[model samples]
Structures are given as structure tokens and as C-alpha cells.
Target: MVPILDYLLQRQISPQWRGLLTALAEEFETQIGQGELRQLMYRVGCRFAAAAPLPPCSSTADLADALNACWQETEWGYVELSDEPEYLRIAHSCAPLLGFGAAALSWTPAFLEGVYQTWLSALGAEGLSVVQASEFDEHATIEFRLGRHPV
Candidate 1:
């Protein structure tokens, strides 16, 4: 059962969208720069979160479940949330952003940052911020941290 589920989760993005995202990444990077492209993608993510707000959740597990439902519905991948003394650690795996091509990687994770920031803020995590903590690992997973706003 776990193997089958892993297979499903590892499904690749469709070639059509992959090509389009790759091209768009190139164009955006060439025209507006990677920083600007990241900001744009972040806004796109914020809009996505706005369109699909999660249900009220009282516990970390419940919140993870709600977030997983959203990810599964969109085939965007799933996240594991861990409670830490200082912040929430978010490990997101199998995101379709990889399909945007290697060049897109430098900025695409910002999209997830934006998505999580909005969602967490909506959950009453005011005064906190979500930021990428690490780059994509070999398994295409990325790490994010949600904590008090940086000085």
C-alpha cells in the first residue's frame, strides 16, 4: 500500500505543462529577472491560497490533513508539518515546480513560501513569516520555516 501510494505521489507533471512552464521560466528570467519572477510566482501562490482556504484546524495533525487535501486535489504534492520550539517546520515533497525546469528552481520555491505564508496568516499566525529554509534536495523536497518575523 505504501509503495503504491508513493508511486502515485511521484507521478510527473504532464509534458505539455512542463514545456510551457519551462518556456515561461526562461522568458520571465530573461525579461524581468529571477527576483522579479519569484515575486510574480509568489503572488500567484497567494492567489491560489486565497481561492482555496483550508478548514479551521485546532491541531497540527488536523492542519496537515487539511493542507494535504489541498495538495492532493491539485497534484501539487504533500507536506509534513512538525512542531518545533521556535517555529513550524514544513517539508514539502514532490511539488510540480520541478517541471518548470532546472532554471526555475532558484525562484519557484518562493511560490510555496507565498502559499504557506498566506495560509498560516489566515490561521491567525499574525506577526509570523514563512521563509524557505533550504534548497531542493535530491528527492526534490524543499524545507520551509514559519516563525516570528525576521529582524
Candidate 2:
């Protein structure tokens, strides 16, 4: 496990803050709807990617290293990228989205989708799209696929 993540996992969140976050998540969903909230979060993620741009990577390994470094710094999860016949498969794990409460989990993964999409686009994958392909699993991992959108 990453040292920062290990420390974070060891720390406990206060119940008051947890309840507040839960209420805020429920309010956001109630006011904006899940889809719109996801879009908003996606934009927020785009901004994050822009703020902490990755250096140019000449290969997939380099890209992975760069991404891991960024994730380590941000304490966001780590990712595993695999080349597939049709698309690039991204398995991201250990994200702290659960800190926002269960309600937020339904939409917060879109933020990661946006972050990856923007980062890959900046890396010259102009026509590829990054989309969440699975929900958070037991390990707080989510799957994303990067490929051209179907017609």
C-alpha cells in the first residue's frame, strides 16, 4: 500500500464530518440530479488534471510511472493500465470517494473518468474516450475503458 494511503486509512473520520458529508452528498443529488452532479464533478476533475499536468511520456510504462507519481501526491488511488485488443483497460483502486459518503459513490467516479480522459487527450489520444465501466468493488476499485466511442 502507498504510505500516504496507509496513514490515511489509519486515521479516523469524525462522525460529525461524516454526517455532514453525507448530508451534502444527498443535497447535491437532490438539487442537481446524479447525471448533472457527475458532469459537475467531471469538470472539477478536468480542472485538477489541468492544474497538475503530467510530463510527456514516450511509452506506457513511463505514463504509468507519471500517473502513479501524481496519484501518490494527491492521495487519489493508484491505477493499472493494460493494453487490450480494442481499448486500453484502466483499473483504479483505493480512491477516497467513500469519504464523501455512500451516496456520493454513485457519481464521484465520473471525476476519475474526466481526469483520465483529459490526461490521455493531452497525451495525444484525441479520439479516445475514457469512461467508467464498473462500480466500486470491495477494494474501492473501479474500472474504466479508454477507446473510441461506438457509433
Candidate maximizing lDDT: 1
In order of appearance, the predictions have TM-scores of: 0.91, 0.87
Worst 10 residues of 1 by lDDT: 1-10
lDDT of 2 by residue, 1-151 (tens): 4556545643544455667777888889778988898999899889989998999999888888999999988777699988899899999988877767766888989889989998999999998899899998766679999998785
Candidate that scores best on TM-score: 1
CA lDDT of every candidate: 0.86, 0.84
Which pairs of residues collide in model 1?
Answer: none
Where in model 2 is the C-alpha error above 4 Å?
1-19
Q: What is the C-alpha local distance difference test score of candidate 1?
A: 0.86
Model 1 clash number: 0
Tens digits of per-residue lDDT, candidate 1, 1-151, equal: 2554445533667766867878878888889987888898899889989999989999999999999999999888899999999999999988877677777889999999999999999999999999899998767689999998567
Report how far off residue 116 is in candidate 1 (Å). Answer: 0.4
